[model samples]
Every structure is written in structure tokens, then in C-alpha cells.
Target: MTLNIVFMGTPDFAVPSLAELLSNGFNVVRVYTQPPRKSGRGQKLAKSPVHQFAELMGVPVETPESFRKPSVIDDLEALNVDVACVVAYGQILPQRALDAPKEGCLNLHGSLLPRWRGAAPIQRAIMSGDEKTGVQIIQMAKGLDTGDILLSETVPIQPTDTAGTLSERMSRTGAGLWPRALAALSRGGLTPTPQEGEPTYAHKIDKAEARLNWTRPAKTLDCHIRGLAPFPGAWCEMDGERLKIHLAEPSQGDGKPGEVLNDALLIACGDGALRLKTVQPAGKPKMSAEDFLRGTPVGKGTILT
Candidate 1:
């Protein structure tokens, strides 16, 4: 029997799971996504990717400001959904909404919990230099991502992996995992295991954290830069202008912190040095350090604050 499912999600990361369910013939009764908000330099309203995709698939969509209202819960309850599948929905569900579905809700989380169980798991895992992370399907509860595990699949953390790359990998992994987990739930054989060990919360990344601290070890600095790449990028000042570092490599060299070691843009840190691999200057395209140095002369002892 096809189960009645309600998909809740926002952003491109959540798109695959919804697609997977539809492609596999799950009975998706409705989809919930956040209302579009004004964004961009011009502040024009932009619809979320999930909303656009749902419309294309001809599914009913809901964009309530909050689920705390009784009427919202009443509306959801009237649907008689068997389960809700949530992925990066970006809103906290009210208890009534959580309880509206008969078989409970499940979430596609981007970490191997009980670690990184909060808002910025992918960024936190990369910034903290974690060796591995994964996608997890969990039985949703009241606490933020503090849910019982339904299924998990680990992915290795490559040395060169940035938040962008890791997030992409998790998205694909989530797509593959969701259909099977939902199928098992439909079959009445899915067992959820309680999360084990102390949970480390991945607090949201502040915009201030994007400023690169050359005083840190080269390896740590590399992680910091990579983790924040492609958005609010790890930044430093050079020649009185802010420069964003998108990619870098650990190097064996030393000087005063932020001091350039050679013409290669090997900047000294507290512990070692880092060779700038790729960077984007303000109002400029991302380019290799070699090309950047060639265009703008910077040599030994030139400090990057």
C-alpha cells in the first residue's frame, strides 16, 4: 500500500529527497516550505528552490508563517498524513503540527550525530577539522536534531573538502537513503535507536567568524578558510583591502604572523605557514595565488593583516 506522506523542506539541499520519493511513487499529499523573502542586492523576493520544484511537480504547497496556530495544525491534521519528511525546512514545527501526522515525522540531517546536531552541522564539521561525517535519517522529536536514529551512512571527510563539497555529497546521500527508510517505515519494520554519547551543538556561524586569524596554526587556518568558502568566506586584509580565501594549503615555513614568506603568498601563522591556493579579492574573480601575485606585487616580509 502506498503511504500518505507530507514533505517539508526548503533550499536545494532538500530537493533530492522530495524527488526521490516522487520518482519511487510515494503518495506525497502535500509539501511545506518557508515563504519567500526579499533577498539579493535589489531586495526582490525570491522563491525557494523547493517551492519552485513542488510547483513543477504539481504538488500542493503550504507556506504558513508559523505552525503554532491551531488553525494551521487543524489544516494539517485534516490531511490525515501517515508521516512527514523534513529536510532543511528552516522552521521549527509546533507540537501540534508534529503530532498531526499519524506515524510521526522523520528528518534528513547532515551529520553523524550525536555530533554537530544543530543549525550549521556541515560548516561546523569542516571548520572543526573532523575526519568524517555523514547523512542520517532520524525520528524527529521536539529537540533540535536531537532525534532517534533511523538510518545512517558515513562519508569520509577529504582534506580538500569544503562546506560546499560536503553539502553536495550529503545531498546525494540523503536522496539515496530517504526512499529506503520511508519504505521500511511503510512496511512497519523500521526501528529507531536512541542517540548515544554527548551531543555537540553546532551553533550557527556568525558573520564575524569569516575573518581569518593568521595567528592560528596553518592547518587550523586552512580548515577555517575552507569551511566558510563560497559564502561569507574566510577573509584577511592585504594592502588595506579585504581578501577572501576560498582554498589554501598547509606549508612548512614561518615568520611573524601574517608575514609573507616568499613571492608565492605563503603567509606565516602562529604555528606554521599556509600557501594561498585560491582566493578572491574584493570585486574580483577567484584566482590562483601565483596569478594574483603576478598582477599585484607582494614579496617577503609583506604582512597581510
Candidate 2:
């Protein structure tokens, strides 16, 4: 039997799970997403990725600012959905709305519970130099990501993995795990287990945090650079201009922190050195270190702050 689903999501990360549910013949009655907000250089209103996808799928969509309103809760209850699936919905759900569905709410969180259990799990995992991270399907509670796990799947953190790449992989993995979770839920066989171990909160990454600290160990700096790549990129100041480091790796070398070691874009850190592979100069497109060097020479012995 097809389960009646009310999907709550907003960003691109949530699109795959919504698509999977529809493709698998689940009866998705309605979608709830965050309202369109001003974005980009023009500051024009922009619809969320999930909102655009939901429109294409011909699903009725609601962009509610909050679920605290009695009418909103009443409307949700009117749908009488069997289950509510939430993925990066960008808002704290109210208990009234959570109780609207017969089976309670389920969330597909980006990280394993009790660890990196907050807004920026994927980025935090890589930034902390974790060896592994995974996704968790949980029975949602009112607390922030404090929920019992219904299902989970681990994914390794590769040496070259960035936040963007890791999030893409996790999205697919979580989408694949959904069918199994729904099957178990339908049969009343899905077990909810309490999350174990000490919890580490994954706070939202600020743009200011992307500034590279040359005083840190090379390996730690490498992780920091990779973790924030492709957005709010890890950057350093050179010739009074910001140079965002898109790719870098720890290498053998030592000198005063932030000192350029060679012509290959190697910069000494507190412990070792970092070999910058790709970079983006302020107001310029990303380019290889070699390409960047050709145009703007950063000779050896130059200090980068």
C-alpha cells in the first residue's frame, strides 16, 4: 500500500528524497517549503530548489513562514498524511504539526546522530578532520536533531573530499536509504534507537571563519581549506587582496607561518607546509596555482597574511 506523505524541505539537498518518494509511487499530497527570499547580485526573489522541483512535479506547495499558527497546524492535520518526511526544511517544526501525521515526523539528517548534530554537519565533519561521517533517518523530536535513529548508513571521508562533494554523496546515499526505511515503517518494524556517545554540535559556518590561519598545523589547515571550498572559500591575504584557496594539500616544508616556500604556491604553516593547487583571486574566476602564478607573480620568500 502506498503511504500518504507530506514532504517538508527547502534546499537542493532535500530534492532527491522528495523525488525518490514520488518515483517510488508514494502518494505525496503536499509540499511545505520556506518562502522565496531575496538573493544574488540583483537581490531579486528566488524560489528554493525544492520549490522549483515540486512545481515541476505538479505537487501543491505551501511556503509557510512558521508552523506556530493554529490555522497552519489545522491545515496540516486536514491532509491526514500517514507520515511527514523532512530534510533540511530550514525551520523548527512545532509539536502540533508533528502530531498531525499518524506516524509522526521523520528527518533525513546529514550526519550520524549525537555527532555533528546541528546546522552544518557535512562541513563540520570535514573541517574537524573526521575519518568518516554518514546520514541518519530519525524519528523527529522537538529538540535540535535530538531524535532516535530509525536507519543510518556510513560513508568514508576521502582525503580529497570537500563539503560540496561530500554533501552530494550523502544526498544520494540518504535517498537510497529512504525506501528501506519506509518499508520498515509500513510493517511497523522500524526500531528507534537512542543516539549514543557524547554529542558534538555542528554550528553554522560563518564567512569570517573561512580566513586561513597560517599559525595552525598544515594538516589542520588543509582540512579547514577543503571543508569550506566552493563557497565562502578559505582565503588568505596577499598583496592586500583576498586569495581564496579552493584546493590544497599538506606537504613537506617548514618556515615562518604564512611564508611562501617556493614558486609552486607552497606556504609554510606552523607544523609543515601547504601546497595550494587551485585558487581564486579576488573578483577573478578560479584557476590553477600555475595559471595564477603566471599572471600575478608570488615569488618565494613572500609573506602571506
Candidate 3:
């Protein structure tokens, strides 16, 4: 029997799984994503990445403000889907919605279960300097990520990995897993196991946390910077203006924290230093440290606040 699927997700992270599912011949009857929100300086509305991709693929899409509404849940039940595959949906599911599909709702979560069991898993993992993290297919339960693990795969977190880079790799790995999970589901071969160990929450990142604190050790600062790069970037004040760091590496040096160590963009930390590799100045596109310094020279021995 062909399983009818209803896809629920809102971001780029979900698209690959949806694509993989469709490519492998899953009957995706509908897609549910967050509604379009205002974006950019123009303040024009922008549909989520999943919404756009679902449309391009000719799949029907629904954007409900909340599933708290009975009508919303009623509409979902109307789909009569055998399964609902959710990823980064950006909304909490009520128990009713979880029970709507014939089998149950399954979530494609970013972290190994019982750890990073909340909104900012990937960023939290990198920021914590974890050498390993992985993806999981879990049976959605009533509480926050307290679900049985259905499938999983471990992946190493390389030293060079930023939140952005790691996310892309994990998404692809998850894309491959979705097909296997669904196939196993069809054959009744999946074995669900209870999650073990104490859990850690990956709380949503606040903009206040993005400010660079040079008083922290160089290695910690490096992880912090990488964890928040490319979006809500780790930033610092220099020359009385804001500078966003996209990539930085720890190096040998010593000075008062935030002091400019040399002409090559090595800035001192409490314990060591870091070379500013990729950066973006206020109102400017991202550029290399060399390019930025060529256009705007920052002298050594100057202190950054």
C-alpha cells in the first residue's frame, strides 16, 4: 500500500527531506509551512523556503497562523494522510495534530535525542565545542522532544565547521535517512527505542548573545563566533562602528583583551588571539579581512571596545 504523507516544515532545512521523499516516490498529499512574513528593507512579504519549493514542485501548501485553532487541526485531519513528516516547522504541535495521521507524526530533528532538544540545536552544538553531533528520526510525542528514536546516524563535527556549514551537511545526511525510514515503515521493520541520558536544551539564541566578548578565551571565542556566523552574526565594536565576524581562527599572541595585536587582523583575547578572516562592516557585504583592511586601514595597538 502506498502511504499518503503530509509534510509540515517551514525552512531550508526541511526542503531536502521533502525532495528526497518525493524523489523516492512517497505520496505527499499536502505541505504545511509557516505563513509568509515581512522581510528586507522593503518590508515585502516572503514565503518560507519550504513553501516556495513545495509550490515549485506542484504540491499543495497550507500556512496556518496556529494549529491551536480547532479548524486548523480539523483541516489537517481532513487530509487523511497515513504519515506526517515534520522538520523545523517553527511551531509546536498539539497532541491532536500529532495523532491526526493514521500512524503518527515523525520529526526529523537535528541533534542526538536527549541533547539539543529545542530550537537552536546546530548552533548550540558548535558553540559548546562538541566534537560529535548527529541527526535522528523520532516518533513525535506530547512533550518537547521526549520521543522514541526511530532512526539515527552519527556525524563528526570538524574543527573548521561553522553552524552554516554543518547545517548544510547534516541536511543532506538527513535527506538520505528519510527514504530509509519510510521504507522501513512500509515493511514494518523500524524499531523504536526510548531515548536515554539526561537532556540539554538548545534555547533560541538572543541578539544580545551575538556581541563578541574578547575577555573570553580565544578557543571559546572562536567557537562562539563560528556558532553564530552568517546570521545574527557574532559582532564587535571597532572604530566606533559595528563589525560582523563570519570566520576567525585562534592564533598565538597576548595583549589586553580587544587590543589590536598587529596589522594582519590578529586581535587579542583574554588568553590568546584570533585572526579575523571573514568580516562584514556596517551596511557592507561580507569580505575578507585583507579586502576590508585595504579599503579601511585599522592600525595596530588600537583597542576595540
Candidate 4:
């Protein structure tokens, strides 16, 4: 018998897994995503990527503010699906919802278990300078990301990879695991194993952490910049304004930390320097360093506070 599936997710990261399931002819009866929220310059209400995708596929979508309500749990129980596939659903599900499905919930997480076991795993892995990170599907438990892993695959963290770039890759690659996991599920052959080793939390990124501390080593700063790239960017004070760095690479240079080394956007760090490749000036669109400098010339010898 085909498993009747319900998918729960929000944001772009979750789209591929849902897509994979549908592509493999899984009977996805419904989808649950976070409520649409106001965003962008106009503050227009924007549907989450998962919500938009589900709607296009003609899957029913629910956007309950919280599953704390008995009705929400009741509604899920009424669906009575075989399994709930969750990926970045953005809420801690109560135990009642977990019991709604016959086989319980399975979460597709962005990091290897026992390594990064909380929110923001992909960003945290890059920020921690890990050479490898992977996606894992785990049997959901009450605790956060503390479930037994069912399937996992490691992916390399390239030197020049930003959080955005890595996420795109992980999403597509991780999608393939859904079919395998479900096949294992239908045959009652899933062998979930408890996570081993010490656990680490990937705490959500705070905007305060985005402030660049030039006193840190160039390598550290490089990682920091890439980890938070393309959103909540790592920034520095430039002539009393914030200059967000979207991309940079460690380079050879030596001077007082935060000193402008040359015209190529090379800024000295505690150990070395970073050549800023992409940046966004305050109140301006993101642009190449060359384009940014063309409009706002930051002369050498000036310190970036």
C-alpha cells in the first residue's frame, strides 16, 4: 500500500524534499507551512517558498500559528496519515502532533547528528570551519534534533562556499534521500540508530554577531563572512556607516587590524587581510567591490572602525 504522507516545512530549504517525494509518486495528501508574513521593502505579506510550491502542486496547506491548540492537533489526527515528513517547519511540535501519524514524524535536518543538533546547522557548520557537513533524516522526538538518524550523506564544505551556496547544494542533494527513506518505511525495514558522540547546538544567528570584529584572524573573519553571507551579512563600520561584506577571501597583507591596506578593498586583520569581493553599502543594493568602490571611494590608510 502507498503511504499517505503529510509534509511540514517552510522556506526554500524544505522545498526539494517535498518535491522529491512528489516526483517519486508518493501520495502527499497535505502540507503544513508557517503563516505568510510581511517582508521586503513594501512589507507585503509573502508566502513561504514551501507554501507557494505546495499550492502550485494542488496540495492542501495549513498555516496554524501554533500547534499548541488542541484543534490543530485534532486536525492532524483527523488526517491520519502514515507519516509526517518535516523539514525546517520552524516550530517545536508537541507530542500530540507526533502521534497523529501512524509512523510518527521524520525530520530532514541539515547537519550530521550529534555534531550540529539545533537550528541553523548549515550556517553553523560553515562558521565553525568544518570541512564536511551533511543532511540526515531522523526519527523525530520531543527533544530538539535528538532523534535517531535513519539516513545521512556527507557533503564537502568548499573553501569559497557561502551559506546560501551550500544550502542550495544541500537542498538538491538531500532531496534524493526521501524516496529511499520512504521505501525503507513501506517495507518496515528502517533501522534508525541513536546519534553518537558529543552533541553541539547550532544556535540561531543573532544580528549582533554580524558586526565584523577586525581584531579576529583573517581566516576566522573569512569564515564568519561566508557563513552569514547573502543575509544578515557580516558588516563593519565604514566612516560611521555600516558596510556589509557579502564575500571575501583571506589574502597576504599586514597592518593594524581594520586598516585599509590598498585600493582593492583589502583590509588588514589580526593575522592577515581579507580582499572584499562583494559588498553592500548602507541603503544601497548589493554590488561587486569594484562597483561599490566606484561610487563610494574608501581611500587607503583609513581605518574601518
Candidate 5:
């Protein structure tokens, strides 16, 4: 028997999950997404990916600021959903919404829970130099991602992997894993396992954190650049311009921190040197280190502010 499911999600990361359920022939009674907000260069109101997708699929969508209102809870109850599947939905589901689903609410989080349990998990895992992180289908609860695990799939974190690349892989992984987890739940075979130990929260990334600190080790700097790549990218001051570090590698060199050690854009860090591979100067497209060097020259002992 097809299950009555309610989909709750917002960003592009969550679109695949909603599509997966729809394609699998689940009875998706309704969708809950964050309301449209003003954005972009024009600052015009824009609907979220999930919102746009749901509209195209002819599914009724709700965009309540919060699920705390009694009327909102009443609206959810009106749907009489058997289960709710949430993925990257910005808003938190209150206790009432969680209870509204007969079976329960399941969250498709982008990291191994109890590890990176808050916003920005994908970026945090890469920034911390984790070897592996993946999607976790957890039984939702009141606490912040402090939910029991329903299923999980581990994905490797390559040295070259950026947050944007990793997120795309994880998004597809979550879509593939959802059906099996839902089936297990339907069959009463899914066991909820309690999370172990204290959890770490991944606070949202800020523009301030993107400023590169040459006082850090080369490895840490490499991770920082990789973690924030393609969005609010890790940056450093060069020639009075903010240079975004799109790619870099750790190396060995001898010089004061933030000092240019070579013609190849090797910048000295606290412990070693960072070989910048790709960079983007403000108001310019990304270019390779060699290409950038040809345009803007800097030699040994040159200070980088």
C-alpha cells in the first residue's frame, strides 16, 4: 500500500528527495517549504527550489514562518499525513507538527548525526578535515538533530573535494537511500538507534570567517579554502584586492607568515607554505596560479596583507 507522506524541504539540496518520493509513487499529500524571500543582485522575491518544484508538480505547498501556531497545526492535521519527510527544510518542526504525522517525521540530514548536527554540516565536515561524512536518515525529535538514526550511508571526503562538490554527491546519496529507509519503516524493520556521546554544532558560515589567516598551518588553510569554495570563498588580501582562494595545496617553505616565498604564489603560513592553485581576484573570473602570476607579479619577501 502506498503511504501518505508530507514533504517538508526548502533549498536545491532538498529538491531531489521530493522528486524521489514523487517518482516512487508515494502519496505526497502536501509540501511545506519556507516562504519566498528577496534575494540576488536584483533583490527580487524568489521562491525556493522545493517551492518551485512543488508548484510544477501540482502539489499544494505551505510556507508557514513557524509551525507553532495552533492554526498551522490544524492545517497539518487536516492533511492527515501518515509520515513527514524533511530534508534541508530551514524551519524547525515543533512538537505538534512532529506528532501530526501518524508514523513520525524523518529528517534527511547531510551529515553523520552527533557529529555535524546543525546548519552548515557539509561545509563544516570539509573545513574540519574529516575523512568521511554522509547522509543520515533520522527519526525526528524536539532536540536539535538529536534524533535516533534510521539509516546511514558513508561518503568519502577527498582532499580535492569542495563543499559544493560534496553537497551534490550527498544530495544524490540521500535520494537513493530514502526509499529503502521508508520501506524499512513500512515493514517495521527500521530500528532507531540512539546517538552516542556529545554532539558538535556546525554554526552557519559567516563572511568574516572567509578571510584567510596566514598565521594558520598550511593544512588548516587548505581545508579552509576547500570548505568554503564556490561560495563566500576563503580569501586573502593581495595587491590591495581581496583574492579568493579557490584551490590550494600544502607545501614546505621558509618565511614569515603571509610572506610570498616564491614566484609561484607560495605564501608562507605558520608551519609551512600554501601553494595556491586557483584564485579569483575581486571583479575577476577564477584563474590558475600561473595565469594570475603572469598578470600580477610578486617575488620572495613580498608581504601579503
Candidate 6:
């Protein structure tokens, strides 16, 4: 049927779905991505992954700051798209925009419906120590993530899974679901299921929340550390310098919270202890805890505040 699609997305998570749709022969008429922003030490303008990929695929792109303008809505209506696929587009789509597509807008959300329904879903799931989470494709509505679920797939949360790793898996899962969902929609075989369970909002991750509080249980601390890893990493002050903890595992041990039990970097917590595996000192590259100790030793019995 050569369904006409309008793809709206930004960031790395959205790239796979866009690529999948194109590869599967969906007629993507236009792509909407966030505008490039100043980034890095030099503050150079950086394009989003989706933007670069769309350009490489020879697809037309637009980066309007918002869709509130009447003209913008008019422009979208002019496209006459059959469906709009949105993934992490980074904006609250207005009702007019949602209604523009003939088959309604579909959102690829990175969480099980009715739970973690907001920004930072993946990080929130990991930080909360959830046993499992998944991706949901929902029919877009005016409210935030309060839409009818069209499709979903669950994935387990391993003890070692970080937000970065979990997101990669969820992205692939979403890419696979899109084709089947679109096919069902085409044949009128898809049923929209209302999201069940009490909803939990996933507020955006703030850098301030990444500070490690040694008073917390080892399990909680382990989850927090992994949830924010590879970006705004969970950190602690060691000798008045920030030491980011990238990898750690909970272990059996006991001491005053924040105390270093041994030379292996096994730190005491409110309950149990954590053996740090990877760490990064301020302004330094990530290194194994053993390697970090060789050059700059944190002696046993040293307290980490």
C-alpha cells in the first residue's frame, strides 16, 4: 500500500527505527529533528544522529523549534502523511500536529506502559532497580505518554545492565515491533489497549542526583551507579576530588557507611558493601579500580565521603 510516513525523532535511540522503516520500504516523505545545538569543549554546533542519518539517506529534513505556530501546523497538514512515527522528538506535540496524520501519530516509548511514562524512562527503570522493563508503541494523544498501546515487548533487567546497555536493547526491540505494528494497522487488525496499572512518572535525570550517598544500601547504590553510568556518572568525593563510579557490584561486607574495607576498593554501605570495578577520576579517562589504585592508592580504612 506504500504507506506515507512522516518521521519525527532525535538522538541515537531514534536512529534504528528510522533506518528500519526506510529499509522496509515505507515511504518516508519528510523527517523532523531537533535543531543543532552548541556542544563539547569548543561549543561547536552538533547535529543529532537522526539528522545526520536522514541527510545521508537523501530525505528532506525540518527543524522547527516548535509546532505551536499556525503556519507550522498548516505546513504539516500540507504533507498529508498517512502516519507520523515519533521517537524521543524532545517536544510536546500539540493536538493539531497529532491530528494531522490520517492514521494518527505513533510514539516509540522506552518503557512498559503505565510505568516510567515520561522522560528518562530507561534511566529511571535502572535507578529504581526494576526486575524488568520494555518498549511500547502507543497511539499519540495530547497528554504525556497517556495513549493507547498499539504494541509492546518486555525485556529483563540484568544486575549488570546499565541505562546505556538497556537502551540499546530496547531500541532494537522497538525497531522489530514497528513493521508488525504497521502491517496490523494497515489491515485494521490492531487493537488499541488502554494502559493499565498505576502510572509512574520518570522525571528527567538531573546531574545533581548522580552524587553517591554512601548511607544508602549497597543494592540501591549499585542501581543508582549503573543507571547513570556513561553520562553524568554516579560520583563521590575522594580526597576532595570527584571520582565517578562507572561499574560496581554489591557484595557481602559490613562497616561504617562510606568506609573502605580493603585495598580492593570494596566500600561499606548502610547494608553490605560494593566492590568497585571501574572508575574515572576528575579530568581522567575511565580505568579499572585496580589500575586506579596502583597510581593513586586509597588505603584500607580510608573513608570516602
Q: Can you give the TM-score per candidate against the true fold?
A: 0.97, 0.98, 0.99, 0.99, 0.95, 0.98
Model 4: per-residue Cα lDDT over 205-275, one tens digit each: 99899999999999999999999987789999988998999999899999999999998899999999999
> How many collisions per candidate?
0, 0, 0, 0, 0, 0
Clashing pairs in 6: none
Off by over 4 Å in 1: none
Off by over 4 Å in 4: none
Give me the runs in candidate 3 sitting further than 4 Å from their true place.
none
Residue 226, candidate 1: alpha-carbon lDDT: 82
lDDT of 6 at 80: 95
lDDT (C-alpha) at residue 136 in model 5 = 91
lDDT of 5 by residue, 181-253 (tens): 8888788899999999879999999889999889999999899999999898988887688899999999999
lDDT of each: 0.91, 0.93, 0.93, 0.94, 0.91, 0.93
Per-residue CA lDDT of model 1 for 1-305, tens digit only, reads 57899999999899999999999999999999999989887999988899999999999999988887788889999999899999999989877788889988899999999999998999999999999999999988998888899999999889999998888888989889988898898789898899999899999899999988889999999989888987778999998998989999998997899999998888999998999999888899999988888888887899998
* Model 4 poorest ten-residue lDDT run: 111-120
Question: Candidate 3 on 58-172: residue-level lDDT in tens?
Answer: 9999999999999999999998888999999999999999999998999999999899999999999999999999999999999999999999999899998999999999999
Predicted candidate 6 versus true structure: per-residue lDDT over 1-305, tens digit per residue: 66899999999999999999999999999999999999998999999999999999999999988888888889999999899999999988899999999998999999998999899999999999999999889999989899999999999999999988989988989988889989888888889999999999999999799999999999999999999987879999998999999999999999999999999999999999999999999999999998999999889898888
User: Of the candidates numbered 2 and 4, which has the greater lDDT value?
Assistant: 4
After best superposition, candidate 4 residue 186: deviation in angstroms?
0.2
Cα lDDT of model 2 by residue, 1-35, tens digit:
57899999998899999999999888899999999
